[model samples]
Target: MTRPGVSAFSVLGVCALIGLAGCFGPPAPAPTGTAAPTSTASPTASATSTASPTAPSSPSVAPTATATVPPPSSAPADPTPTGEPTFTGFPEQVARLTVYYVAIGDNGVSGPMIGCGDSLVATSTAPVRFTDQVGPSIGALLANKSRDVGLSGLVNALYQSDLTYLGGELAGSTITIYLSGQFMLGGVCDVPRAKAQLEYTAMAASGATSAEVFVNGRPIDEVLSLK
Candidate 1:
C-alpha cells in the first residue's frame, strides 16, 4: 500500500531500488542448497567412487599377477612326485592259501572274528596263491579291487594297497607277519578286522597253530591305536 503523498512512481522506484540491491548483492542462498548436495552425499559418493575403482582395480591386478606367479610357485610345491609309491608291485600268490577279509554287513559274513578281535567278523574261502617272500595271499587281501561277488561284501581294510606286507616269519608253531605302509581306515572297526585278516591269513598260509602280526616292525598295536 502506498502512503499519503506517495506517488505510484515513487513506489515503483522503491521496488526498482530493492531489485537493484538484490542484483548488486551476493547471490541467493538457494544455490547453497543446490551445491551438489555436498555435505553428506557428495563426500560419500566420492568416497565410494574412489574406493570402488581402487578395490576392484587392485584385486584385478593382483589376480593376474598371482595367477601367473602360482604356476611357478605351485610347480615347486609338488616339483616331482616325491612321495614314495604305496606298493610298487602287485601281490603274486606262489602257493595256495586262504586269504581273510573283514566281514561287513550281513552279505557274506561267516562268523565272528576268531581269538581277540571283538568288533569284526571274517570269512575266507577264496583260495588264492602266495609268493615265498611275502605271501601273495595278503596281496589278494590287499588288492586294489577286492574279492569277487560273494566276497564283495567283505571289507579288506588293507585292500587299498595302503598296507604293504613286508614279510613273515615261521618259528615252530607260531607265525609272525610283518607289514608296513600308510594305513588308511574306513572307520575304527577296521582295526580288529584288519588284524583278524592278517592273523588268520598268516595262520592259513603257514599252517601254524597261532599267528602274531607286526607293522613297520612294531606290533599291530601301534597301527591299530593310531587309527
Candidate 2:
C-alpha cells in the first residue's frame, strides 16, 4: 500500500523539471517595434609597479709625472803660473881692447909736447878679462910705451912713468880711467898738454868725446886746476 501511493517528493521533482524546462527553453520572439538586450561583461582593474631613484656616479682623476736631475763633474786643476819669465846674464857678452898713442911734436908757438895730431897712431884688439879691472893686455902696453919700436918721438901722455891702469869704463859720452898711483908733471905747461893728450887718447880708444881721470880713487880735478 505504501509503495503504490504518490509521494510529495516525486510531485515536487516534476514541478522543478517543468520550471527548468521553461528556463532552458528557446528564446521568446522579440516584441514588435522593440530591440533585444545586448550581453554586457564586467570591467576589471590592473595592477601598476613603481621604480626607485639611484645616486649619480663620481668623475675619474689622472696621475702627475716627475723629472730627474743629473750629477756634477770632477777634474784636475791647472798647474802653471801666469807671468813673465826671468833671465840672468851680462848686458854685453863679448869685449875687446883698442890702444891709442900720442906723438911728441913741436907746437907752432910752444916747445915740444905730446898730442894725438888729430889722428890715432895704432889700434890693437885683445881679449879682455871678465873681471872689474881693466884688461891686462891693454894696461901692459900702455905702461910700457918705451918698448914700442915705432913710437920714437911719441910719448905716452897717460903714463905716469910709475902708475898703472886699474880700470876703465865708458859712461855715456865720457871715458873714466882709474889709476893705481899719483900723476906727475914738470910744469904748468904740462896741464893743458896732459889734458889734451888724455882726452884725445880716451876718445880714440872708446869712441867718447870727454875723459875723466882718477888716481888712487881721488878725482884728478880735486888736486889740479884743469880749467
Candidate 3:
C-alpha cells in the first residue's frame, strides 16, 4: 500500500496558481469618461489677403478770355477863306484916308508931313473913277480948317495956275498924271515943294510908290528931285 510516493497536496497547489492567472489576464479596459488622445491634425489656419484704401482725383480748370480797346478820333481844322481884306476897329462902311500937311519950323523952313483922317466917301461895289473919289477927298482936306496944319490948298493952287489934273492912270507901282501943257512955276524951289505935296498926297491916297508927270501926253524928264 505505501509503495508509490505520489503527494496529493503538491498537485493541488499547482492547480490553484493556474486559476489565479486566468482571472487577472489582459489589461483592464480604459474608462469611458476619459477619451483616448486622438492625433487628428489641428485644422491648418487659412491665409486671408487684405486690400489698402485709395485717394480721390481733382477737377480740371479752364482758361479765361481778354478784351480789346479802340483808340480815340481827332478833331478837324478851322476853314477860313483867303484874300479878303481885314479891318480892325473900323465900321464896314468907313475907310481910312491919308492926307498931307506942311511941317513948319523957325524961319519959314517947310517940308511935307503926313496926316491920317477918316472920311465918309461914297463906296460902291461898281468900279469907281479915281478922279471922282480922290479929287473930292483932297478938296475936303483943303476946306477943313480944323484939320489943316499950315497946308494952304497947294493942289488947288495948281488948279488955279492952269495945271489941270486930267484923268490919271496907275500902272504897276508908278502913277501917271496928265496935264494940258508944260507949266512953269514961280521959281526952282517952288517946283520941288509943289511936286512933293502932290506926290505924297497922291501916294498916301492911292497906295502908289512913284509918280510921273506928263504934259500933252509926253513924259517930262526934268521936273523935281524926290529927296
Report each candidate's C-alpha RMSD, comma-separated, in the order given. Answer: 26.5, 23.8, 23.9
Better of 2 and 3 by TM-score: 2
Q: What C-alpha lDDT do the candidate models reach, one value each? A: 0.65, 0.55, 0.47
Query: Tens digits of per-residue lDDT for model 1 on 82-130?
Result: 6877854545654444666555654333664443333244344445444
- Range of the 10 consecutive residues with the lowest summed lDDT in candidate 3: 116-125
lDDT of 3 by residue, 129-208 (tens): 33334443344433333423333422322322345556566688877666564444444444544455556555655567
Top-scoring candidate (TM-score): 1
Q: Per-residue CA lDDT of candidate 2, range 75-96, in tens?
A: 4366477698775533443456
lDDT of 3: 0.47
Worst 10 residues of 1 by lDDT: 113-122
Q: Give me the runs in candidate 3 sitting further than 4 Å from their true place.
A: 1-101, 104-132, 135-160, 181-184, 220-227
Cα displacement (Å) at residue 166, model 3: 1.3
Any residue pairs clashing in model 2, and if so which?
none
Clashing pairs in 1: 93-129, 93-130, 94-130, 94-131, 95-130
Residue 50 of model 3 has an lDDT of 22
